[model samples]
Target: MSDTFDAYDDDGNRYAVPVRRSYINTSDLSGPGRIEGLPSFHLSGGGAVNRIDDQTFEIVATGKRLTVRA
Candidate 1:
């Protein structure tokens, strides 16, 4: 997956369906390289938080990873 790593669109033009991404941040309430909690809090078989900005949140899996308190 490397047509010279294509993904430019600002008058450059390049998009041939090449995809490969990754992200697994726990959430320390910060930004970038985030990893704090959620190893097993609440998530039976469906787990997905998905939010990279505005506080930050990224917890995805087959299951197990979701917590909340005060």
Candidate 2:
């Protein structure tokens, strides 16, 4: 099963968001970097999961770094 927690940005500051992903299988929440309007996560096969909202994120990685709106 999975659980949810609060949301936070790169800084140690907390956000007003809820339902954060709580990994139970492993503890590897390493992210590549934050793009302007893209995701801050990087997959092994050049993929990313951009955070659109508190519970809405999309993949937009083409094996390369993407620069969206910070």
In lDDT terms, which candidate is top?
Answer: 2
* TM-score of every model versus the real structure: 0.16, 0.25
Q: What clash pairs does model 1 have?
A: none
lDDT of 2 by residue, 1-70 (tens): 2222333434343332222233333334784443233224433344444556555334464222222323
Residue by residue across 1-70, what tens digits does model 1's lDDT show?
1111222233443322222233467556585574333232112223334434333233455322222211
Each candidate's lDDT (Cα)?
A: 0.32, 0.37
- Residue pairs with backbone atoms closer than 3 Å in model 2 (clashes): 36-68, 36-69, 36-70, 37-68, 37-69, 39-50
**Against the hidden true structure, what lDDT does model 1 obtain?**
0.32
